[model samples]
Target: MTNLAKRIIEFVQRPGYMPMKPKTLAKKLGITKKKLAKFEAALEEAKLSGEIRFSEGGRIQPKAARGSHLGIVHRIKSGDAFIILREPKPVGLTDDIFVDRNDLKDAQNGDEVFVKLLQRRRSRGQRCGYVVEVVERATNVFVGTYLEEDESGWVQIDGKDYPDPIWVGDPGAKGVQEGDKVVIEMLRFPTVGQNGEGVLTKVLGSRGEPGVDTQMIIHEFGIPDEFPDDVLNEARLEAENFNENDLTDREDLSEMTVVTIDPKTARDFDDAISLKKIEKGHWLLGVHIADVSHFVQPGTQLDREAETRGTSVYLPTKVIPMLPEIISNGLASLQEGRTRFTMSAFIEFSAEGIPIETRFSRSAIKVTQRFAYEEVMPIIKAKPSEPIEGVSDEIRELLKNMHELAMLLRKRRFAKGSLELDMPEVRLSLDTDGKVTGAFEAEHDESHEIIEEFMLAANIAVAVRLNDEGIGFLRRAHADPAEAKLKAFSEFVTILGFELEKYQSKKHLQALLRSVRGTPQEQAVNYAMLRSLKQAEYSPMEVGHYALAEDQYCHFTSPIRRYPDLHIHRLVSSLVCDNVTYRGASAEDLIRLGHHCSTTERRAERAERELTKIKLLTYFEERVGEKITAVITGVERFGFFCRGVEIPAEGLVHISNIPASESYEFDRQAMALVGRRTGDMIRLGDKVIVEIASVDVDRRELNFKLLTHTASKPPAKKGAAKKSPSRGKKGSKKPNSKQSKPRKKKPSTRKKKSAQKRRKKR
Candidate 1:
C-alpha cells in the first residue's frame, strides 16, 4: 500500500474501531477514502492530560458512590474548610469530615464539591476533615473590587481562597478602575495566582456614592432586580374582577368601621381591625386579613414563585416583594373605599381578660379609612382631631374602646412572660432620589403595641381552630432557650447585683423583664435575653409560642407578604370548603416547612443587614472627621465596635487606633473592651466620643478613631521658677534679659546626677 493508504489503515486499527478497513473511515467522515488519508496521522496522534486520562473511552465519568463523598461548601475560612453534607462520609464510614487546604480542589466557597476526606479530627469537640475535590461551581456572579497590577487590570473577589484573579481584557474592561466596586462574571477558572478572564457584568458607581452601596448589595445577594414579565401579566389578569358571585359566599362587613393602621408609606394594608361593645361587660373585636390565598391558588405559576421566595424582602431603599406589585399593593391591599376579600376572626372578650367566644369567616369588607400609626396614636392617647370625611365620630369612639381592650390584652401577655424585648429599629430617611440622607431610631408607642396585640390575638384564634381540628397547617413555633446561653446571661447579670428570675416558664421571663424595666441597662439586658431565645419558625407542632407566652399563636395575618400565612389561610379555607373540622398536621411536614421558612428568614435578614451595612458605610463617608457620641456595642481582639447615638452608623476602632501608652483587652464575660493601664473601660452601654475616620463602602466597613477624654491636669505648682540652660555648650548659662536665655531642658540624667552631688556637698 502507498503512504496515505497505510496511514488510513493504521487509524482504523485504533481500539475504538471494530474494523481496520479504509471504507469505514470514508463512511465515518462522510468523505472519500483518499480525502480521509490526508489528516489520518493527526487524528491518530491525539493526547490527553493526566487528570483527563482517568476517564473512560475519552469521556469523563462521575465518581462512584462507594468511595465518593459529596456536599455543598458553606465556606472556606482560614484554619479549615466546611461543607454541609446529607449523609456519606469519607473520613470514616460514619464520620462526616471537615476538609483542609490541601484536600480542597478548585472549589469556590459556596460550590458543590465531591470531596475525598483525608481524616476526621476533633477540634473543640467538632468533626472536621480535609477535602479533595471541587466537582462544580455554585455561582458565577462575583462581588469584588477591580484591581490593577503593572499594566493590566483584574478583579480580586472578596472571598476566601479565590486565587483566580478575573482578568479584564475586553474593550469595556478598562471602564472600572482600581478600587472600584464592580460585579464580575467568572468565565473560567484560572490556575492559582493566575489571572482568570472575566467580563465586567456591572459597574456600581464609584465607592462611597450614596444609594450605590444599597444597589450593590441587591446585586451581590443575587436578588431579583426586576419582576419577571410573566408574573406581572398573571397578577394583572388575576386582578380584573370583584364580582358579586365571589362576594355572595363571603360575609359582608362593608358597614363596619374597619380601618388599617400602618406606617405612613405602607402600600399593602394586609390587616385591619374593628371593635364594638357586645354587652355591658363584653366586647367584640374583629381582625381582618387580606385573603391573598383566595386569588393565588396553590401550585399555580404565581404561587410556585411565591413559595420559592417564601416572604417579601424589605430593604432600606426598596422592596423585593413576594408577589407582583399589582396584587401586593393593589388588589390584596385593603385600600379605603374599595371592597376586598378578607379572612376575618371575630374574637369576643370579657372584662376579666377572657375570650368569651371566637368565630372565623370569609368576608367582603370595605375599609373606611387608612390611618397611619402616627395619626391613630394621638386618638389612642384620647387626643382626637375633628372627625374627617372618612373618619366619623362613631369610628373614633370605636378606636378608643379598642385601644383600652388592647391595653388589657397587652398587660396580660406581659404577665404570661411575654418578653419586653427592646428591639428598636433604625429608620432611614432618604432623599427623593433614594439616597440615605440620615438614619434615626424608631420608637414603639401605644398605637404600635395596640395593633400588635389584636393581631396576636387573631393569629392565636386561628391557630387554636387548626390545632383542634387536627388538620395540616402552618404554625409559627419557637423552641426553648438554649440552657448554656441562658446560664451565661444569668451569670452576666449577677455581676451587676441582679439575678434572672427562675425561668420555670415564660411567666418567669416576664417577671425578669419587669424587674429590669426602669433600669439604665434595661434595653441592653432585654437585647441579650431576646438573643438567647430561638427564632420562631413555621412548623406543624401543636406546641405554643413560648416567648409570646401563648399556646395558640399562628401566623394567620399578613398573607400578602408571608408565604406561611398564605399556607395557613389555604388550610383553613380548605377545611371550610370540604365541610370538615380541623385535622392535625404531620410533624414531618411541619419540620420541613419550618426549616424552609427559617432558612429563608435568615437569608432575608442577612440581605437586609448587608444592605444596612453598605448604606451605613456610605453615610459615614460624608461625615468622616466629624465627632459623634456613641455606645460600644461589641468588642473583639482586633477591634471594638461602636454605634453612633444620633446616627445609625456603627464602626470599629482598630487596636492600632488605641494609644500605645494605654493597654486594652477584650473582656468576654463582661462584654467590655477594657483599658488595663488606665482602668477605663468601654462596655455595651458605656458612652464615648468617636471620630469617623474612614469608610470602605465595598466591604461595608467603617473605621473610627477613639478620642481619649483625658482628665484636665492640675494647674502647675506655684513657686516653680524656670531656669536658664546652655546654648551650644555643655555648661549652663546665667539668666539675663539681653542674652535671650534658653529655657532649661528638663535636666538630663547625667546633669541631674552632677547637680545632685553638688547639692549633697553643699
Candidate 2:
C-alpha cells in the first residue's frame, strides 16, 4: 500500500481525533489531488473491513486501534527479520524492531506486518518480537529463478532465504522452464514442511542476462521502469509544441554565445553558462537552466508521472529517467545550436567572484558549444603550451576567466567555513553488450568546480530573494550536529592527534581534512567528518545550511533530474514573468513535498550506490583468490575491515579466519582488536595481509580470510562452533548467522558517581 493510504488508515483508527472530511483530511495531511484516489481507496477499504465507520457528514471514525506494531518486514536468508516501523510508532521504541526466525511466521520481505512487542528474555540476552498479524501484504509478486529439482519444478526466490528449495507445486509451474528468471504470484506462503506455492506469471529473462541486474534492482526497489501511454502521449505533444509561444516576449539571448560543459557521456544539457565582459575587472555571468516547468505544467499526466518518480535513477548499466526521453533529452534539454527556453540567473560580478547584483529572467538562448570536462580542464588550468584545436583564443580566455572567478568563489566559501568533503564516486564502464568492462573513480577538476560555484551562487541568490518576499517554499536545510554526537566525534579525533575543540569547528575540520588529503588516513577522516554532520534535506522552514555556511540555499538547476528545482523554476518564472505566479503549493503542501522529495532522493542514491557496488564486486570476481595487502579501516570483535587502496572495495576478515594463536578482544571505545596473549593488535590505520575468500553479489559483501603468519597448528574442524561474521567498524556487513545476543554496555564511572550525587542532593 502507498504511504499516504497507510497514514489515512492509521488516522481513521487513532483515538481522540474526531472524524474528518475527505477533503479536510487531504488538506490536513498535505495530500495532493494526484494522491486522492489512494486516500479514498484506503478509506473505503477500512470502512468495509469495520476498522473504521462512516459517521454523519461523511467523516471517518475509528473503532479502536489494533494492538500491534505496523512496519515493513525485511527478511534474511536465515529467516531472521527486521521491521522498519512506519511513523506513529509506539512511544519510546527504536526504529528497528527485531523478529527472529521462528517469530517470522509466514511473513515475507516488504510486507506491512502488525507485530506484537515482546519482552527481552534475561537468560537469552536478546529482545524477542513476533508478527502478530500481517496488516497488509506489500506484494504477492515474487522475482526468482525457476529450477528443476528431483523431477519437480521449483522457483528459488532471488535474495530470499529458506532452509530448503521451494517446490513449485505442479499446478502453477506452467510456461516457465529451468534457468529462467521469472515473476510469480504466490498462491500460498510457505509452512513448516511445505514450500510456498506460486503461479508463474511473467518471465524476466535467463539468469546472468545482460541488463538483468539493473532490471532486478528496478523490480526490487519498485521503481517504475516504463512511462504509461497517457504520460508518453502528453510528453510527445508538449515537446512538439515547445517553440511556438516560448519564443515570444521572452528575453532573447540567442545572440549570446553560451557553452555547456558536462561529462563526455552526458546527453541532457540542463544548464549552461554565458559570460560577457562589462569592463575591466567586471563581468556579467549567465547561468541558464532548461525551463522544465514550461513543458511539465502542474496537474498534467506528465507532471503526475514525474512527481511519482521524483528523480531519475542512474544505474551502472542503464538510467531510469524521471521524465520521458523525448522531453529530458529533446526540446527541454539545452542542446548545442538549439534555441531553447530557459530561466536565466544574470549576476554581475567583480574580479573576486562576489556578486554585485543578481537578477532572474525568462529567456530564450542558443548554446553555441559543448565541451567535455576533460577537454575544458586543460584550458581552465592554462597549462604551459597546451594547444586548443578548432577553438578560438577568445573562448579559451572566457574559460580561463570563468575558472579564475570560480576559484575566488570557492576560496570565499571555504573562508566562510564550508566543509570540503573528499568522497570518491565510482562509475562503471560498460561495453556495447552491456557487460561490466571496468570501474573507475569519476574525475573532478576546475571545469566541475566552475559549474558548481555558479550553480550555488544562483541557488543562494534565489533563496535570498524568495525569503525577502516572505515566500514560504521548499529550501535546503542542514541543522547543526547533535551535542551528544559532537562530543563522541570530538573524542574520536583526539586519537588522530588533534585537540577535541578543533574538530568541533567547521573551519578547523576543513583544515584537518586538508592536512590528511593525500595521506593513508584520508578516507577514515573523511568518513568521520561526514558522520559528524547532519544530512541535508528539503524543508519549508528557513533553517540555514550548516555545511555550506549559507543563510539561504535551494536547488535551482537541473530541473529535468530533480523536482525541487522544477518547483523553484516555477516560483522564479512567476516572480520574473509578469503573467505567471507561484500559487500551486501551500506552506503545508511545500512541507509535505519537501519531505517526499528528500525521501525519493535518498532512495535514488541508495539504488545507484547498490548498482555500483554490484558492478564493482563483479570486477573483483576475477581475483577472488588473490592475496592483497590492505589498510585496516575498521575493527570489531568478529573481524577487521581492510580497505584496498588499489582495489575499489573493502572486505572483512572474520575472527574465525584469524591465525589460531591467541584470542582477540574488541575495545569498543578504542575501536581496535587486541590479542589476549600475543600482545598483537589490529587497529585502524594498520595494515594486514588477506586473501579474498568469497563474494556474494546478493548480499553485496566481499569476504576475506586473514593470512597472518603464526607458528601454531590450525584448529581441527570437528564440532567447531559456528562463528558469527565479523564486521568492519562502519557497521556495513550483515551475516547469515543466528541473531546475536545484545552486549551489555560497561557502566561509566562518571555516570554512576553523578547518579549517587543526584540521590544525595535529593
Candidate 3:
C-alpha cells in the first residue's frame, strides 16, 4: 500500500475517530494543494482494497462487520426512532430499521449510530433493530426556555426531541430569570430514567417581548443573522469601488426598454426583462440579472460569507440577507433609472415561444420602469386608448408583449406534463410593533406568471449552455416520486371523490389537480400532492426538475440573493467575457456545495415557518372562545385537524369534545370519523364551525372545539331518542327509573348538569 493509504487507515482507526467526507478528511490531514489529487487517489485506492468504505452521505469509515450498520437516528415525539442506513444494507433488509424507544439506548435525534438488527420484522413489514453505539452527536448546544424553581433552574428545550426539561442546578446562573429564553450547552443528554444536565451559556430575553421570539428562532435553527466585520468591510469596499460608467468588455444595453416587476415591499431588484418583436414573427427577449459575481470574487471574504449563507432568508419581520445590504440592496440592486452591471441572457424565439437561439453577455442596463405585481395587471388590462398617467407608450407596449409570450410559454409548459402546485402564500399584515394584525393569501396572477416564465427560461438556457460545454454546475433537481407514494396519493384523492386514472403518469396527476381547481377541495388536494413528491434540491446530477418538466434547469437569476445563481453567473460570465477566468469546480466539490446549500435553504424555510407559527399563535391567544369557519385538513381516530379559512391557523379538535350521546369511530380508508349512533360523518375538506379552546405559545400547540351542531346533525331529542334505558324486555312495560325515584339534587349539581347540556347544544 502507498504511504498515504497507510496514513489514512491509521487516522480512521483512531480511538475517537468519526466518519468524515473526503474534503473534511483532507483538511484534517493538513493536505496541501499540491497533494490533494494524490490524496484523493489514495483514498479511492483504500476503498477499492476493502480497507475503507463510503457511507451513503459520502463519509469515509472503516468497513463494518455483518449484522451491524452505520446510520443516522430520526427520533419522533413518541421516543421511537428510525435508523437511516448509511452503509450497504444486508440481504433482505429495508432501507431503514425501526428501533423501539426502549431499544434506542443513548441515541438521540440526528445522531450517527451503529445498530444491531434483531432479525425480526415489524408488523408493518419493516426491519426492527436496536442502537448499540452512538458514533457522533449532531449538536451539543440548544435553545430553550429557562424555568426557575425555589433554588434550582431547568431548561425546557424547544421541539419534541427533548420532552423533559434539563436540570441546570442554579437559578441565578447567568442571571436567568423565570421564563427567560436562553441557550444551553448540554453536559449530558437525558435518558428514560434520569434527567439531562446542562449549563446556562447565554440569556436571550424574557418571553413575549418584541424581537425575542425572532432571536429564539434564529438561535434554535443555528441561522447566521449577523455579518462578520471582515465580510462587512469587504462589502463596503466593493460598494466604494463600484463605478457604473466602467463598462469595459461589457455589452451596453442602457438604452433598452427594460422593466422590473416585483412585490411592492421589495427592497432589492435582481432581475429585469425586456422584449421586442422582430421580423418574420420572431422575438428577442432579454433577461438581465444583477451581476453579483462582479463584486463577490472567488476566494474573498464576501464570497465566503455569501456561499455560507447559500440563500437570503425572508422572515416576516426582517430579512437575513446572504450578502450585506451594501451589495445586495445597493451595488447589485437593479433599481429604476440607475445603471447596473448584469449578466444578460438574450434569446431569439419563434412566434410559438420556441427558442431559436440563445446567447449570454456581461452587460450594463438602466431599468426604465419598476412595477409591482399588483400594478402590472391593471395597466395590461387597460384599454390602449385610455392610457393612465405616467404610463409611457414604450413601457405599455413592452408589458403587452411580455404577457403575450408568457402565456404561450406557460401553455406549452403545462402541455408537457408540468405540474402547477402554486398554492397561495398566507401573508400576514403586521403593525409597527411586529404583531400580526391580519393575514390574507397572496394572489398569483398573470403578472407573477410573466416573471416566472422568463426566469425559468433563462435558467434552463444557462444550464443547457453549461452542460453542452462540459462544465460541472449545480442544477435545481426534483426527482420523480416513488410509485408507492403516488399510489397512496391516488387512493387519497379517490376517497375525496376525485379519480386519478393512472397514478404513475404525470398527465393524470395534472388532470387530478385541474379537476379540483376552484373547489373547496383544492387546498387539501394540492397539499397532499406536494407531500407525495420529493423536495426540489440543488445537485450536480442530471436528475431534472419534475415540477417544471425541464430536463436542463438551474437557478440563474436573482444572483444577489442566491449563491447558486451567483456561481452560475460566474461560470456564464467567463464564457461571454474575455477578462474573466473560469475557476472550475470538480463534480465532488459541486456535490458537497449542493448539499450544504440545500441544507441551508431548508433551515431558512423551517425558521420562517416556525417564527410565523409563533406569531400566529400569539395572535390567536387574544382570540380564544371565538368562532371561525375551518376546513378539515386531516382526520384521525383522535378527531380531525382543521385550519381556519380566514386566519389559516391550525388546531386540533379532540374526539372527547364530540357529543356524549354518540360514539365516533375512525374510518382510516375513508380518511374520516363516523358517529355510530347518529350516522353523521366528518371527513377531509368538510367545512365546519370551531371555537378556539386554548393556545399554548411555549409548546406551540392550539386546540379547538368542534361545534357539533354546525359540523353534523344535532344530537337526537331527549324524549325522541330511539335507544333509551326506559325500554324494557320485549312486550314488557317498565316504569322509567329516574321518574319513579323523584330524587332532589343539590343546586351545584343542577348547575353542572345545566352547563353540560349547554355545551352539548353548541
Candidate 4:
C-alpha cells in the first residue's frame, strides 16, 4: 500500500475517528490544493482495494466487523449526532461515535439507539457511525408554545432540539390559547423531511406570564415539584409526633452556645456550630447537623420520596424540597432558641488547627442565636473594648473564636494543596412577576468561609469515622483528570503567558493559580482548569477527591437538603446511639443510589443555569444595541463567546460582526481568531466592548455584535504600516470601502428574476 493509503487506514483505525467528506478530509490532513488530486487518487484507490469504504453520504469510513452497538443519541442543532455507547467499547474505539445527519435516520436527541460503526474517519481522529435502530425514547412530553396559523394548530417546541413546530391538530383541546405555554405529548416525532405530531397535555399558562417560565422549566426537565399525598401525610405525622422535651438516646447540649449562620434568605437551617477553647490550648468544635433521619425513617413513604428526589432543587424563584416543607423547614430546621435533634461531629483541634480527635454523637441542642452571614462578620470584627450595643460578650467572643479557627483551617487547607477556585456567585434580582430586574455577584467573605470550613471539617471527620468502621456509604469522589486534559490546560495557560512547569503536579497547578490571582487571566485560567478536572460525584467507590486534596470525603453536612447526608446520618446514628454497626446499603445498591443522586444534582444545576439565562435574556431584550464591557470566555472557528463583566450575561460575538475589511481565520494553537490582513487577534480572556445584537427568548439565545476588541497582550504586527481593526470607530465601515456613495441593493431583484426563470423552466 502507498503511504497515503497507509495513513488513511491508520487514521480510520484510531479511536474517535469520524467519517468525513473528501474535501473535509483533505483539509483535516492538511492536503493543500496542489496535493488534492494525489490525495483523492489515493483515497479512490484505497476504496477500490477494499481498504476503505464510502458511506451513502459520500463520507469516507473504515469497514467495521461488528454489526451494531447500543448507545444513546445526542443530536446537535446542525443535525449531526454522537452516540454515547452503553456496551463495553472496543479497545481501539471511542466511547462515543459520530453520526452524520443523513445517517441519523429518525433518531432524536437522548434516544437510546443501536449504531453501526462505519469504516471511515473524520477530522481529529473521531470515529463515525450511523444509527441502526432506536431502542428507547428519552421522553415524549415536551414544553412548547401554542400557535394557530389559518386555523391550523401547532406547538412550537421551546428548544433547538426540535426547531420545527409540532402539528397538534386542535390547540384548544386542553383549553390552551394561541399564545399559551403548554405541554405536548409527542404522537410522532419529526423526521428531517416531515413535521412532528403531538397532542396538548397541559396548559401551564399564557406565554410570558408570571411563573409560567418556572413551570415550563419544571415540566421540561421532569423535575418533581409536588409531593405525593402519602409523603405529605408522613411529613405531617412526623411533625405531630415531634416533642422537644423527649431527648431519649440523645445527648443534651442545649446549654452550649450553639448558633446557626446562614444566608439572610435561607429558610431551612440544616447545620449549626459551637466552639470553645479547651485544655492544652485545644479547641473543641461541635458541628451539629439536623438529624433528618430521625423524622424521615427508612423504608417509609417520606424516605422513598426523598430518595427519589435525591436533593433539593434551589431555583432562582423557587425551591423544590426533597422532603416536604413540613419536615425540611419545620421540625428539621435548627431555628434560634428551638431545641432540635442533630447528628453532631465533635473535633478537637490544636491551636495550630491540626485535628487531634474526632467523635460522633446523636444530640439535642438549642441554638443560642441565628446570625445571618452578614451579621457574623461584623460581630467578629468588633473590638472587645468597644462592644456593639445589644450584643452579648459570649456571642461576640464565640464569633471571634470561630473566625480565628476557620481562618487557620483555611490557611492549612491551602497549604495542603486544596484547589481554591471559588468564584463569586451571580445572583439575579427578580421582580414579583419573576422577571429579572438586575444581577449582582454575591460576596464570599470570611463569614461564608467560616461556615464552609466547619462543614468541611465535619464531613472529613465523618468520612474518616465511617471508613474506619468498614461501612459502605456513598462518598463524594473526584478523580484526577486525564493526563491529556492536564497537558491541554497547561498549553492553554502557556498561550496566555503563564508558566506551569508540571501540569500533572497539584503543587504546580496551585502555584500557577496563585500567580494568576487577581490578574486579568484569572477567570479564564480558573475556568480552563475547572473544565480539565473531573466532576465531583457521589459514589461508593474509594476514589479520593482531587480538588479537596482529601483521601476520604463524603456529604454529611446538609441532611435537610441532601439524601446522601441523610443516609450517612442513619449510619452514624446506628454507630453512635445504638452502639451497633449499621450495614448500610450493599455495594451495588450504593452505586446505583450514588449514580441517581449525581444525575439529579446535575439536572438541578442545568435547570437553574438555563432558567437564569432565560431571565437574563428577557431582561436584555429591551436593551438591544446597548454596548457593554465583556470578557471573552471562549473562542471558536465561527465566533468567540463573551460574558458581560457587570451583568454576567454571556453572548456570542460572530466573526461576521467584526468590522474588518479582511476575514478572520481561527488559530487553534493560540485559541484565537486572527485577521488575515490586519494581524489583529481576538483571543480568550480578551476584553471587548459588545452591543447586544438580539435576544431570542424562545430559543434562549443571546447574540452580541463586537464594537471593539482589546487583546490581553498586544499582537505582533504583520506589517509595520498596517493598522489593527481593534482601533476602528463605533459602527465603522469596512476599511477602504466607498462609504460616501450608497451601494445599490440589486441582489433581491436578481433573486426574483432567477426565481421567475426557474419557475418558467419548471
Candidate 5:
C-alpha cells in the first residue's frame, strides 16, 4: 500500500495530469495483472484518506496540501461556527477545527465543506480555519424572509440555526413583502463584503401565519413532507386489502387485556403492553410492537420508501412519517379493538423486575383499550386500598403491578451504573387555529417510566438473542468518550462539589450523578454529564451502550416511526415463525443501512429542535419585555445563557448587562461569571431575574437583560491604596481597570492576640 501510495503521488504530479479511473491508473502505472486488484484497493484507500482527490472530470489527482479537508460546518452560535473535519489530518491537530465568522465563506449549518486549514499559532489555544470550498451544500433551497426596502428587493434566509440575516438579491422577489417567507435558490455565494444572490423559487405565506412557521422548518430541513404518487398508491392498496393468509402461523392474543399507553395527541400507537399475574411469585409482562415489516415487504415500493426515509420526523404540530399514513396510522398502527399483525416479546419476572426468561414470537393481537399517559398516570398513582371510581378492578390491578415492576427495574438499572438525569421537557398547547395558546412543562411520571422500562427490557433481550447467535445485526453502540472530555468534565464537577480524583471511571460518573439527584444543581450537572457522554449510533458491531450501562441494546419498539425496529422485527420473525427466514438485509448491506439511518435520525432530531425554537420565538414575540425567573444554564467569556423555570426555550444574557458598578469576569473552572467588585457569582444553576430584551425570529433567539441590579460599593477615602478585581490565567474576562476602590486597614494580629490574652486573665 505504501508503494502504491508513492506511485500514485508521483503519477498525479506528472505534467498534463488528468483524472482517470483506478483501472486506467493501474494500467498507466504498469502494474502486473495479478497485482492490479491490490493497486486499485490502495488507490481507493488513498482517495478516502485525502491523499488523492477526484476532480469534476472523473479524474484523480494529488491532493493540495492543507487546502482541502472533508468537513461539516456547524453554525453553533450567533455569527460563529466550528467545522468538524471528517478526513484524517496530521497528528495532534484535533478534528474540531474552529472557523471564525469571516472565514465561513458562505457555508451554513449541515453543509459538507472542504476547508483550508490555517497554521496553528501557539498563541491561541484552539486551531481556527477557513472554508475555501463547499464540496456539497446541505440544501440548495431555503425558506427566506422576503425584504423589499423601497423596491430594492432581497430575501433573508429564515433558518433557525443561523443567526445572521443572509440577504440574497432575487430579481424575481415577485413583490413579496417583509413578513412573507419565500423559498430561494442560491445562484452565487457571497465574497468578502457582499451577501449571496439567489432566485426566488417559492413564496410561502407571511410570518406567524397559521402553519407557515412549521412549513418553513420542513422546507429548510428538506424534509420529504409528502409521499410520492406511486408510494401513496401502493400504501392505499395494502390498507384496503387485509389478507387472511398474512395472519397464518401467528398466535392470536385477542383474549389478553392488551392496551396502548401514549400521549393524548399521539396519532400512531406503535407499541402496547399486557400484564398478567399467572403464578404466586411471577408475572408475565408482554410487549407487543406494530409489525410494519409484515405489510411493507422487501423489494416493494413501500420498503424502498421506508428505507429512504429511515425514521419519521415529528415537529411541534406536524409529522413527516417514514411510512405512508395509510400504513403508519391505519394498518400498521396498533389501534384499539382492531386486529393487527405484531411481533411480541413476553418476559416472566418475579415479584421484582428481574427477568427470569424471555420468549419471542409472531402474533396477531387485538388491543382492548387505548389510554393516554395522562389517564394512566392517575391510575398508577392511586392506592390499592383507594381504587379510583369508574376504573375497573382488573385495569387497576394491572396498573399497580406494572408500576411496581417498573420501579424495581429502575432500581436495578441505576444500581448497575445507569446515567439518570431527569431533565425537564417542554410541551406546547395549541388551539384549534394551530396557535400556541400556552407553553408548559410536561414532566415524566411513573406511567412514562413503566412503559420505558418494559420497552428497554425487550430491546435488550432481543439484542442479546441476535448477538448470542453470532448474527450480524445493527446494534445501538455508544463508544467511550475521549480522555480530554473526561478530564474537562472532572474539573467542572470538582468546582461544583465533587472529588475529581476518581471521575475518570464510569462508576464515578454514575456516583456523581446519584449524589446530586435531589440537589438544586442536579439538572445542570445532568446536562453537563449528558454532554460528556458520547452519542449512540447504529452499527453492525456489538460495541455496547455506555449510558444505559448495557452490553446489548437495540431498537425493538416503535417500528411505525423507526426503520431499525422494523428491520429487527423481520430478523426476529425468522426465529419465531416457521417458513420465515431473515433475508431482509445482509451484514454488509446492514452496515450501509445503519449509517444512513443514523444520519436521518440526526436530521429528524435537528428538525424537531428547530421547530421548538421557532415556536418559542413566535410565542414569545408578543411577550417581549415581560420579566421572568430563569436558571443560569451556561456561562462563557462574553455572557451567560438562561432557561426559564417554566418556559421551554433558552436565551442569552450578555455580560455587559451586569450592572456598571461591578465588572464581571467569567471563571472557566467554576463555570461562572463572577462580579469582581461585589464577589457575586452567576454560576450554573443560579437563579436570576431577567427581562426579555428582544427577540429575533430570523435567528430564532431571545436576548435577555439582567433584572438583578448590583449594589454599588461605598466611596473610598483620600490617598488610600486601591484594590482591583483579580483575573484567572485562562479564558478570563478582562476586568475594568479604570475603576478602583480604597482598601480598609485592619488591626494588628499581635495586638488582637494580647487583648484576647488580657481578657482571658481577667
Candidate 6:
C-alpha cells in the first residue's frame, strides 16, 4: 500500500473514534473537515479487503516531536554510516548509527536523514543515532548497462546494492540492449524500506563504443550536450546581423603587424599580438582579445547562456563550447585575414622587460598571420626556418624581442612564488569514427608560455586600472593555503627525505620549489602541494592571490568562453573611452556571480572526469591481465589506487589482493598509507607493477591485481565470508588460505611543531 494511504487507514482504525464530529476529527488530525471525510471514505473502500473496521468515538494520541540529530549522511559503508552534523565544528560527528545489514532500509549516500539522538557512546565527542525518518534521497541520473530482451527488459544499474533485482519498467526502456551504456531517470526515491523506481531516459551507446565516453562526460558534468533551441536561435540571429556603426570611435589597427599563435587543433582564436615601433626607446606591444561583450550584452538570451556555462569544457575527444558555434568558431573568432573587434592593451616596455607605460583601448584589428606553436617556437628560439607566409623580417625580429621579454616576465612571476606547475595534459587522437586510435601526453612548449605571459600581463594591467578607479570588478582570488594543510604537506615531504625551506615570505615557498626542480617526484610533489590549496574563485574583495604574488589579477583574455572576461571588457571599454557615466554591478553582485560560477565550474569538472573514466574503462577491456608500471596515486582501507605512468588511467589494488601479511595504516596528516607488519609501504608516487583484473564500463571502475615479489601468509578466513563478485559475470578469485590480518601501524616518530613559527612576525 502507498505510505500516504496506509497512514490514512491507520488513523480511521484508531480505538473509539467512529462517532466523533467531522469538525473535531479535522482539528485533531490537522486537516480540514472535508479531507477527514475523504479519509473516512477510504476506510470504507478498504473494507472489501477486511483490513479495516470502524470504531466509535475513538481518538488517536498525537505523537510529540522528539529530540533528533540533524545531519547529512557523509557516507555509508559496511552496514554503517558516518554523518556530518551541520552545527558542529571540525565536522567529525560520530553517528556510528548502526544500520544492520537487514535494516539499511534503502538509504543511499549523501541522503538527508534524521536519526534519533541516542545516549552518548564510548567514543568521546561522538553521538550515535537511531534513524527515525529519511527526509530526502540523493538521486542522480545514472549511466549503466541495460539487461533485458523481448521489448520488456529491465536495466541493472551499477551503483545500487540490491537484494531483489531492481530494473527499469518495459515502456520506460528505450531501445537499449544488454551491456549498452544508457542514461536512466529515477522514477521514485527510496523510502524507509523500499528501493526507488527508475526508467531509462536515453540509450547512449554500447560498451566500448567510440564517442560514448564523451557523451558520458558531458552528462556527468551536467553540461548540456546540445544547446537549447532558444539559445541556438538567438546565437544564429546575432551572427546574421552586423552594423558598421558598431565600429564608431574605435582605434583602427588594420594596417599593423598582427599575428596569432595557437595549437594546430585550436578553432577559436580569441587573442592575438601586435608589435610596432613608436620611438627609439618605446615600442607599442598590443595584446588584443576578441570583444565578445559587444555582441553578447547583459540580460540577453545569449548572455544568460554564456554566463550559465561560465567556461568552455574541453575533453579529449570533443569540446563542449560555452558559446554556440555561430559565435565561438565563426564571427567572434579572431582568425587571420578577418576583421574583428578587440579590446587591446598597449604596453610600452623597456629593453629589459620593465613596463614604462600602459594604454587600454577598443580597436578594430586585422590579423596578418596565424602560426602554430611548433612553427613559431623555432623563430622565437633564434633558429628561424622558412618565414611564415606574408610575414616580414622586421616582424620576425619583433617576435623574437617579444619572446625575450615574455621569458623575463615569466621568470619574475615564478620568482614571486607563482608555483611553476604544468601537469601533463592527456590528448587523444581519434579516427573518423571517433574511436581513440592513440592517447598520449601533450607537452607545453616554449611557444605556449610566450603567449601565456602576454595574456597574464594584459589581465593584470586591466585589473590594476579598474581597482585604481575604485570601481567594482571581478578579481580572481586565491588565498594562501591553510596552515593545517601546509603543515601536513610539510610532514609528508620531510618523511620522503626532502627539505622544504621555511620562510617568512612568498620567497621561501619559491626557494623550496626551486630545490625540487628536475626531480622525479617533482610532479608528484607539485600535485600534493596543489591539493593543499583552495581553488581560485572570482570575487570583488581586494585580498590578493598569494600564489601569484600579484596585487591584482582578473580574467580578461578569453571572453568568448568565460563570462567574467566579457564583464572585464565592458568595464575596461568604459574607462578607456572616458565614458564613466555607465552603471555597473556592485561588489555584492560580483561576489554572488563568483559563487555561482565556481559551483558550476566544479560541475563541469565532474562531467569531464566521468567521460574520461568511461573511455579508460573501455581501454582496459582490451588489456585485461597485461602488466603495466604504475604509480601509487591514492591509498584507502579498501585498496590502493595505482595510475598507469603512460596511460593516465588508474585502478584499484584492494587490501584483500595484497599478498603481504603486513597490516596497512593510513597517515591522515601525511596523506599516505603504510604497511605495519612487513614494513612494506605504498606511498604516493611509489612505482609498482599491476595487472588489469577487471573492468566495469557501466560504472566506469577499473580493478587491478598487485604484483608482489614475496607471498606473505594470509590471515585465517572467517566462517563462510562471501566475496563480492568483480563486476563481470566471471567469478572472482578467492582469498588465499595463508593471508593474515594486517597489523595497525604506529604513529610517526616526528615531534609536533607549533604553528606560532608559521605566522608572520608583527
Query: Can you tell me which runs of candidate 2 are displaced by over 4 Å?
Result: 1-142, 148-154, 160-168, 171-174, 184-199, 244-246, 277-282, 350-352, 383-387, 496-499, 579-582, 661-663, 708-762
Per-residue lDDT tens digits of candidate 2, residues 1-762?
Answer: 555556777775654464566778878788788978877776666555666654322445554346666678888656788888875567977457788868877887777666777877325454457887655565566667778867777777765354455656663354666777777777778855567777777767775678776776776567788999999999989877766345775899998988899988987889999888788688898999998988999889999888778888887777788899999999789888888899999999887777899899889998888898888876766654677676777788778878878888999999999988889887777887666776567777778899999899889988988889777778989988775666566555444333333445787677667866765556776788788788899888888999899989988998999998988888888888653555647764586578778867887888788777776676667778888777777777788888765665778889887878777777665566666655455666666678888887655678888885322111212211122111224544321111111122224656789899999999
TM value for model 2: 0.79
Best by TM-score: 3
For all predicted structures, in order, the TM-scores are 0.76, 0.79, 0.89, 0.83, 0.82, 0.75
Q: TM-score of predicted model 5?
A: 0.82
Task: Compare candidates 2 and 3 on TM-score and give the better one.
Answer: 3
The segments of candidate 6 whose C-alpha lies over 4 angstroms from its true place after superposition are: 1-140, 148-154, 158-167, 243-246, 276-283, 350-352, 384-391, 503-505, 577-582, 637-639, 659-682, 708-762
